[model samples]
Target: IEKEGWSGEVSGRRKDGSPITILITASLVKDEKGEPICMMDSFVDITERKFMEDELRIKDNAIASSLNGIVIGDLEGNITYVNDAFMELWGGDDISEIVGKSAVTFAEDEDKGRSIINVLQNEGNWTGEITGIRRDGIPITVQLSAGMVYNEKKEPICMMCSLVDITKRKEAEEKLQRSHEELEIRVQDRTKELTKANIKLKKEIEDRKIAENTLLKKEKELELKSLNLEEANTALKVLLRQGEKDKTELENKVLQNIKELVLPCIEKLKIYRLDDKQQAYLDILESNLNNIISPFLQKLSSKYMDFTPTEIQVANFVREGKPTKEIAELLNISERGIEFHRNNIRMKLGLKNRKTNLRTYLLSLA
Candidate 1:
């Protein structure tokens, strides 16, 4: 269609009686009454359209034509036009062979073909890759761009399209993309491996440095130890000689004291023999001395085991022969409060039962 009120594919018969596509234009001429009395129109032979289309065909006959595939259909989807490229790629020779048939017949898949048709119906245009059957009935991929041809009233009458056979290009792109992704994955794996190896190498270097420093320190320590050993040997001999003389002196002094001062004191105490009550006082004094030293001994034992300060305090009170209530009073707490603190201590030390003697446990430490 070329002009307002003009419509139709400007077509004519070729020498072999084949129809060729032409661009026709027509305009309506109205009289003074505004009635369409006469029509004015122009017809472009579009022999060029025919020639170019043939040229496409001729080219395809030679080295495979790289020109895109082409298919043309009326608004109704009837196959009104298709280029030589289409015929060569898809199975159609004469225009009349498919002219009145639905163009979708050539689609490799019916559903996909219907989808394209729906797109054309809804959007008045559709373009994308599609699979079509070749003249040999082989499936070929083509890129198609299509537009609906409209009349002056803007009503779609036909659809014109251009197509490109992109099979090789598409395949090449896919292969390239796959290769790129594979290379990327391999690079990532290689990078991870290298990173791990680098970390291992760094650790080994640190270890080597630590070992080298330790060896140097050991060598120095061995030299010092050798000198110390010699000094220790000489000191041992000297100390042994002094120890013998000191032993004799200490024996003489101890015997002299026992015979003089100790005997006189013992005789005096004997002369004023202690009553039972006085003897009881001496026993109580020894017991109090033991109680005072118990905490110091518990702390010393804690060097071999981890006893918290509260556990140590509880152990000390229990050793002082104080009942829980008295111990709680001395600590300014209730007996129940003391029991709660003791349970916490026992749990922390992994003790099983509340009856487990906390004092006995402390004494057994170390």
Candidate 2:
């Protein structure tokens, strides 16, 4: 009585009273004469099929919402499917805009595209970096992982690919490399500067050492010269002492010769009769000669440092028993000068106010 058969999926209970899902087809069965007899129905268990469909739907949703772009392409490299992420990655508005395109259409280089195809065909998979172009023609870098899909018969059917953006990572790596190179250059420059400074310091130290050595050498030379001068002065002092001793011995010998040889001869000549004027000249000569040769004169000069030469001469004449006028005539000086000199000698001898006579003190010294 129905014009057409009805088919639908329905829920049912199994023999164990468990709930199940099935596909049902119902139609009207007729006997004859176009009269309806009974209704006939067919049931097909679809629980597994429904479950498989639900799982497939969930998987599809996961792929659509993935952060990574996904593509399914035929073995001929034609695009067959694309997820929402893939569309967004390629800057496409809809899957319809990308599904019918060649899989290699977005590859930046034709040669690289061909290579990727060849690797996928031979190895059944390819994973590497690739340059791709967006819908706006902007080039981008990606990490691509692609594999060939197979049928149940193991025949290659299509290629499944996943893409992840790697542009920022590559940029960071390049920046780090540049910074490392710059740091290396700076370290090298600093090392060179330190080396130059070290060299200069070494040179300065060497020059200072040389100056110190020169100063030490000069000091040594001056010390040696001073030592030589000291030795010369010592030798001169010894020679001067020897000369003074020789002069004293010579004066003693001259005084002895006058007393023994010359004075005795003069006394013998006085025994021969001489005129009065001659006798006076002889007395003056004897007095002068005795004064010149007297050891007492040397003793007075040495013992009395304050006595003048004239005072020493007056002392010698007074010691010889000559009066003041006679000593003046012998010395070619005035009598007053002789007396003054005698007075000075007595003062110098510490006998000015004493009762001791100058002549007696002189005789006592002799």
In model 2, state the lDDT of residue 117. 88
Candidate 2 clashing pairs, residues 3+ apart or interchain: none
Which regions of candidate 1 fall more than 4 Å away from where they truly are?
1-66, 91-96, 222-366
* Tens-digit lDDT string for candidate 2 (1-366): 298979999988899998789999999998879778889999899998988899999998988888999998888788988888878888878778888787787899978988898889999999999999998999989999999989889999899899998988988988999999999999999999999999999999999999999999999999999999998999999998999899889878987888888998888888888898788889867876776666576677668968877787788889989899988987789999998898888888999889898899998876
Predicted candidate 1 versus true structure: per-residue lDDT over 37-90, tens digit per residue: 777877666767778788978854642343555666777677876667766666
Per-model TM-score, in order, reads 0.42, 0.55
lDDT of 2: 0.87
The deviation in Å at residue 194 for candidate 1 is 1.5
Q: Global lDDT of each model?
A: 0.71, 0.87
